[model samples]
Target chain A: MSIPQQLILTFISGGIICVIAQLLIDLTRLTPARILVLYVSLGVLIFAVGAFEPMQKIFGAGVSVPLIGFGANIAKGVREAVDKDGLIGVLTGGLTSSAAGITSALLFGLFASFLFKTKSKRM
Target chain B: MDSKAKKQLIKKHSPSTTILKNSIMAFIFGGGICVIGQLLSELYSYFGCDEKTCGILVTVTLIFIAALLTGLGIFDKIARHAGAGTLVPVTGFSNAVVSQAMDAKSEGYVMGVGAKIYTVAGPVILYGLLSGVIYGLIYYIYRTVEQMI
Candidate 1:
């Protein structure tokens, strides 16, 4: 696809994903945290069904930035690992594949804690 | 006031005007973040990183940026306006985790910061990993059945 087309696709898909979350927030009692976890589980299901790659290709960051993308990432990792290393990969693949993102988050979290004193949020 | 009267009064005061603005802000901010992520992925691909590595790098970079912003106290401001726009991204995960730690730093390291850091985000990790294992098992079963066929 052309650059503009790709951009449009990304915007639409990303907007839809957020809109769905917003709808849940408005219409239901489910907290955002719970919805977020549901999105990840949904992502894993999408990945298992082999639809995630197509969505990723069309929407790029739109799909990939969402929590569902994270689930898909884990699914992809495990699939690849299992193909190569059997059942062991099932256990290790998710962590190994997601290691970079997880580790960076922890490291940055620690660094932030050390550098900044806690301040109560002000409305 | 009667209970029904009070309910009506609250509903009357509910800010419907804010919904349009909130949705628009979410679209713009959320789309903007995704655009940046797309650009990062494109850059990594251009640099000859494999697809998986490129994705990992983009996620890591986004999380780092989110954590930094949370530390600087900017993400919260943006989040207040952006709503689901900011919350929908993986960066939000970083923000959620790091902000808790930062918020708890006042109480001390071990109990305050460490114990509470995952207060909200712990579920994301726990459930995400659990779903990963489940998906893996399903995939394995599917593959085995296909082979038998």
Candidate 2:
């Protein structure tokens, strides 16, 4: 049952997310950038409040890949920063801790820009 | 006979041939990605970071590279060769941001710069979250079913 449970949920959940996303694109003015940031932050906030971990266990990358695992990294970074840098870590810890993800996101983004046709989708 | 014969000939063409092309492309491009990764590893050693730090450094460096390429309009070219093979990686993240930024910039500051920059990435993030939520619900259901079974 648990095995079937994972399959059914993965299919339905993943499908729902995609469908909702399509609707937003068709219906709303909100852009995907805000959505992306919101999700990562949401994950971070949820995990902080003990909400997202169970999701992480179930979906694996489904939970972590969007922000490229930075949410969990930021939380851990905050704790580390608190341990090492004291209060400043709260301010800077996310940057230093999740630096790898952010940095990779930025760099690979630049590299990919070159590798592909980055024509604006607006027009 | 002529029209039917042509139709039959077209039908004989398999989609797998296209898949085969893509699979080979994936191998080449995937290998390229790995090679770049390996080169980054070498650079990490040159800088004398421990193995752990080096791993972080490589990823961070790649992020910048991807961003820069996105800005310059070159990464897209490479992505062509790789398909999702390349796009699924960190480089794709960079492409998403850069392109979104460009799209947002057209309508002047408020709409373009402030609001529109997230057009592409917003959905990716949302889908990601919703997926997690659904994943959670599914897992919960699974647990219930297991208990019942």
Clash statistics: count for each candidate: 0, 43
lDDT of 2: 0.51
lDDT of 1 by residue, A1-123 (tens): 877788778877887787677666656647878987898888888998899999899899899988889888888889998888877778988887777877788778878999976555789
How does the DockQ of candidate 1 come out?
Answer: 0.66
What lDDT does model 1 reach?
A: 0.83
Listed for every candidate in order, the interface RMSD values in angstroms are 1.5, 10.0
Name the runs in model 2 displaced over 4 angstroms: A1-96, A103-123, B1-17, B123-149
How far residue B140's Cα lies from its native spot in candidate 1, in Å, is 1.4
Q: Considering summed lDDT, which 10 consecutive residues are worst modelled in model 2 chain B?
A: B14-23
lDDT by residue (B1-149, candidate 2, tens digit) is 59999988886883322444444454445334434644565567788888557656655665567677767666667766555334433445556766666544546546654465455555554454443444344444554577699
Which candidate wins on DockQ? 1
